[model samples]
Every structure is written in structure tokens, then in C-alpha cells.
Target: MNRVILIGHLARDPEMRYTPNGTAVTTFTLAVNRPKTKEGVEQQPDWINCVVWQKTAENCANFLRKGSKALVEGRIQTRSFDDKEGNKRYVTEVVGENVHFLSPKNQGNLFDEPFSPRPPVNINDDDLPF
Candidate 1:
């Protein structure tokens, strides 16, 4: 029962890499905004690290860019490794199960199309069937 769902924007473009066994892997950071406190204090955004594997990883790397909105569904995992200074470091990341792109294809053109005035119809009130 360990699952997590996050909706956020990409902090940077997804980085794609391959494992020794040639498995495609992609990594990215999601910038999720935190809810304000009861005292109305602004909270800093949470940068969550996410990882995708195989075809999904390839798709994310190919389509996702910085500032692209996405919905990530995954599980949390923690791993430990030794740093350069010989100190053990622990890192947490989400292993993505599904990644949904939320941004429109042409975001910049979203508001570029101005509203147009409609033309008047030639129908008369006397022709109404009601």
C-alpha cells in the first residue's frame, strides 16, 4: 500500500541514461508547491526527484521539458550510498509508474487567438416554430 500521486511542473528537462544492461532510465525533479500554513505563511516549493524506466522513461525524456506540467504516480524509495568524502548519504526518489503530461502542446498560443464577433442570423421571429 505504498503509493504517491503528485502534480507538478518539471524543474528541468528530464535526463535520459541507460543502465549497464541497456535499460532506459530517465530522471527529473518535480517542483510541487506546498499549501500555505494556517497562519497564511507562504511555503517553499518541494523539489521531488523522480525516476522512470523503460519505454515510459524514453517517452518522458523525449516529451518533457523544463516548466512542463505533469502528473506523476509512483512509490517512494530510499537508497544509501557512500559519498566522495566517505560519508554515507541517503537519497529518496519516486519510481514512477505512470507519467501524464498536463501541459497543452501550444501553450504560448493559448491566448493568442482573440475572440471574434459573431455575425447576425437572417431568421425572423415570425418563422419561429415554438
Candidate 2:
């Protein structure tokens, strides 16, 4: 299975656009920090390109902004295209299946109220086959 999970901060505000078919698509760059070396020096963050589709794209565009923390779960995809200069350019990006906003509700353009976790369900001991 081709899958990836990334937790990072948005490098900039998400860019939202509509396709000719009116599908919403949003693109953003995630700044993921690299692990520290043995010398304990700080490493430059990896700027990863990510794409979100449909209503999720709209949500991302509306709520996320520069410096917002988020978790992205999706598959990595790579494609190539010819640029205006006639040079072939390759791009690797994560096509987000789910994007969770991790920043505090008070941060950026998030919802007014903080999100609460759902209550856990109670299960009987007999429900287990083992």
C-alpha cells in the first residue's frame, strides 16, 4: 500500500482554486522538521507539497493559514510536466485523504469553539471471540 502520514506546520496560506468541472482543489506546503543529527544541530525543515480535494479542500483553505499546525494522511504521488521554458519538471506531493487541523481553536482562522473528543463506547466482555 502507498501511504504517508505527515505532521507539520503550514508554510503559507493554502491556495484554493476550482477546476473547469467546478471541483475544489487546494494546495499548500508543509514545513516538516527533520530529526536532529548526533551533533545536536538543527536541521532545515522539509517543504512538502500537499493537495486536498472536494469539500476538504475548501475546509483547508478556510481554516488553515501560515504557521498553522496540521496532520495530513494520504498517498504520495509524483508527476512530470513541461514548463513554459520547455523543460520537463517533476513534482512529488501528498494527495490528502484526510487533513486534521492541529492548531488551537483560537489560532488563525479556526472554528469559534474547540473540538471535543467523542465519548468512548462501552463493550461487554462476551463480545470478544478470543
Model 2 stretches astray by more than 4 angstroms: 109-130
lDDT tens per residue, model 1, 14-114: 99999999999999999999999999998999999999999999999888889988999999999999999999999999999999888776642122224
TM-score of each: 0.78, 0.82
- Residue pairs clashing, model 2: none
RMSD in angstroms between candidate 1 and the native structure over all alpha carbons: 9.4
Q: Tens digits of per-residue lDDT for model 2 on 1-130?
A: 9999999999999999999999999999999999998999989999999999999999999999999999999999999999999999999999999999988777975653456675799989999898
CA lDDT of every candidate? 0.91, 0.94
Q: For model 1, where is the 10-residue window of minimal lDDT?
A: 107-116
Question: What is the Cα root-mean-square deviation between model 2 and the actual structure?
Answer: 8.7
Report clash pairs, candidate 1. Answer: none
Instruction: Report the number of the highest-TM-score candidate.
Output: 2
Clash statistics: count for each candidate:
0, 0
For all predictions, the C-alpha RMSD in Å is 9.4, 8.7
